[model samples]
Target: MTPDLFGRHRAVLPDWLALYYEDPLEITHGEGRHVWDAAGNKYLDFFGGILTTMTAHALPEVAKAVGEQAGRILHSSTLYLNRPMVELAERVACLSGIPDARVFFTTSGTEANDTALLLATAYRRSNTILAMRNSYHGRSFSAVGVTGNRGWSPTSLSPLQTLYVHGGVRTRGPYAHLDDREFTDACVDDLKDLLGHTRAPAALIAEPVQGVGGFTSPPDGLYAAFREVLHERDILWIADEVQTGWGRTGEHFWGWQAHGQNGPPDIVTFAKGIGNGMSVGGVVARAEIMNCLDANSISTFGGTQVTMAAGLANLAYLLEHDLQGNARRVGGLLLERLRAVAARVPHVREVRGRGLMIGVELTRPGSDEAAPEAASAVLEEARAGGLLIGKGGGHDTSALRIAPPMSLTVAEAEEGAAILERALRSV
Candidate 1:
């Protein structure tokens, strides 16, 4: 049954739309942290649909809000007053740390980032933009133009003159051997050198943690040190928090707070968890930057009533239940357990992440070269053992990504870790 459906999918869908596994299983339904395939196999969901399911699967609050809102009105233009949209916006603005922050909703992260580019370029009146190497923002033309990852970026022709900056990854770069302080200083010097050689860029955009680059991150406070240089030149700072926002990291609500010594970014783009399963994405900027556009603009389906209701409910549940605190405690235990497991496996290169967003990098045994085949083997083994995980990285997709829902519990973590241990051993 699954194979027949897979054949149909391949026939209808674009080849570029990637699918996992030798035989992709159909996920029929889910509850809590578990899901069942059409063949009656139950698997522990660790990836959470690329971390889109921030809360538990089939969460009652989100389902109830979505159903209730649909019963009333689903489609309403942004021209009218939207109570749910306003409420959700107010909550996000208050939590954003940007003074007088304003929110504009979009259907996806790509559009949110596209809106940010429009604002920063118009405000600074410059077409030059700076983005971190080994980073991915989105798939749209403007967003792809700034993406520096060669695997994901297909074209170099762009409307904005883009300059790739260094220091997104601390473990595999020219400055990898440096200590934390030295690494930060080296990245800052590199930024200064790059700035001197190029025109004044409108803004410097970066992911607090490079999501598609296998959850890689720079040394702490690296962005803060660079912020000083951009500030002096009047260039804006935009934090792409699509994967790092809403307390997914153990220590902070937003990933930029990891470099809080520099204060808030001029603009922030967020998606992928705000609405749980619903599509909710947006940009938050100070009124000056958000309102810099002289002409009118409205998203046709950006902030419809249904999605706003889902966002409001999900955000409220996340805060009221203190899922951030849950992520910190559970994530710590899971990380320690995975580290112990990796120590026994010679092919496991490194285990790195702040909270639930963990990555286990694989390499050929006794060599530094990436072992993408080992990653694929582990993924297949984990699936056979009733576990679902993900894989991605800059080096031929050699990193195993494990990001469960923020509401993951101690028992579930232990269960997933045990399955992962066996999978690694099999690999």
Candidate 2:
């Protein structure tokens, strides 16, 4: 159906089927960082499908790979090994620096996390799973159980052993004064105490940089501290790189690398950009941890032929063009521009992020209000001005997330920033 027709029908659709809180624009086509709606309005897409399309939309190389693979073979069950699947797995392992790693692919990030949780629990024969507060892993039962966000739960909690820790540096300017280092140390000590009291946790799951948690980067030494603590208790560290992996963070191919070389996680989960928007997710476990899983644990459609082809082509394009370098350069430029804009807007409390993943926090002038309404107003204004961004955090917390594709050019980033400036001004 046409975009207009779909919109009209959507207006009358049941609330359950149409549960979108924010109004969505009808996008007709997208290329690189821009999308055109049915009414011929074009938008600078900073969201990039919530960071899923790292290579950008309608990439010719990825499209070609998908087409070529489709003509030859599409589905090859787990019982059989396919060339594309083997190549994709090898490429992921090589890039992740986890030699001898085994990959079990899934169609989405949620499934990837689900699989990782199960694998960690079963391998260690431990019941406790430790995760960070404000972290978003996925929506599956086990994933939700470990996720600290209670908003995601609709029914009784799952019976998984879980502990939630707090992450994020506290700055005096944005809110009340607090020592970030002290807060981090306290959290670590709490974790150590918890570990001492309960059976050792099966795994410690965390987003290298908290994606859904205000895009907050942990305290400088928090990762290393957590690694040391978890190791002391014999717990595996699971880095959920779903939104931060595949060069999105620039300097490192994976966000975990940002934690320092000594903090390499035991297992890393990836999804968003691996297939360049195709439905593919998986975990790269260290050889020892991976060895614990046998043929009994497998997914029939995990690494399908078509998905693997797309993933392999995406990775090849990323490496061949040095997309990570572009992400760093462009991300730095974007952050500088955003900070400049924030300086002019009193409501903009902070501008923070690493690489292409950014967040602009808004607050009421001289008041404690998080100014979530101001953020919503800015979002709507930006949408009207042909720019697409996203909102996160409970209470709407006044944070707008920006995660454009790696293929986005400097010119495009500038245009998006300009559009955002106008939107902020209107608000």
Candidate 3:
């Protein structure tokens, strides 16, 4: 391919495709917490390729593993078993605190979520699934059906059954506050009312920490209440940890730990960081629920040798380096620094999140409504200053998501925060 060929093609691409190319930097390479654009300019990568490159780009261990695996065997039909697949599943199960958990792998987060939803529906023999408002599961038909966001309205894949519930509104500033007992109770009451009026749901799917919906944390006791309700209804709880798992939250290996919930969920979906940017996603389900599906339902590319090798190497890197612990320490420092910066910048409505999954809410100086345009401006300014950031939240898009690699150092965190502060000031 010619050097200009890709750029020329991108220029003529439809607007629908153009939306995916909004990033100011055209990345050619990356390492640790930095990336180089096509122009050879280096930029600090705070977004981590939408929070998927946990170990950073071109990690030596992961690349080496992928290379070795590719040299030996690249693909294997699902009908046949592979050593890498078995090792990957064993490692994921061991880290997930579910030793006997059966894993169903896929090529992306959406596929993993779709598989989990399928299992939930099949096992319960029910058509309806209750999902939280503002939650983002994935783009597949079933995933989108349960995704509370209305922006995915034009999807054609229809689900057997789907229901919506008001999870909780943003209670405090840019952050959704679920810290109080009353707030927790009110959320539970709302869920109860929704269930009372609708058919019993086959499963309840939720992001342990809302990733796309402004990085909101659930109410203090909300998860426990949710568990109780779902158990009472005999419905499974599907924890969609695509964005919040693999120690991104710092304290725990998963975001569910921050919720203080009891026991593990029946089904958990993971992607993004699991393979450190390699195309790998999977459902870690309770053995019983996993057995509900026949082998014929599996994906051909799921758990491919190459992807499995990458996943294994990524996990080994995370554990050996104690990246989770680093995330916690650096995340706390970043939050503290961000809070200070927010206090000075009137446009910054709030700073919220756990560990490295932080969000900065932007609004007009004295306005209550989200200033999505202002947020976009800030993002642009940050990009010009050599930092890559991302926007999240509902349609408002007023929340700036900061999810650096787990390998990010305190110095890098400070540098990213400094760029953000400068952006806010310039805006």
Assess every candidate by TM-score: 0.99, 0.92, 0.94
Q: Hey, what RMSD does candidate 1 come out at?
A: 0.9
In lDDT terms, how accurate is model 1? 0.92
The residue-level lDDT of candidate 2 at 111 comes to: 92
The 10 consecutive residues of candidate 3 with the worst lDDT sum are 16-25
Query: What's the lDDT for residue 40 in model 1?
Result: 91
- In terms of TM-score, which candidate is strongest? 1
Write candidate 2's Cα lDDT for 97-171 as tens digits.
Answer: 765777778888899888788779878988789988767888788888887655554454776878876664344
Shift in Å, residue 55, candidate 1: 0.7
Query: Where does the lowest 10-residue lDDT sum fall in candidate 2?
Result: 168-177
Q: What tens-digit string does per-residue lDDT give for candidate 1 at 141-188?
A: 999999988888888888999998889988987999999999999999
- Where model 3 places Cα greater than 4 Å from the true spot, the runs are 1-7, 10-14, 18-24, 172-179
- Residue 360, model 2: Cα distance from true site in angstroms: 0.7
User: Whole-model Cα lDDT per candidate?
Assistant: 0.92, 0.81, 0.83
lDDT leader: 1
Native-referenced Cα lDDT, model 3 = 0.83
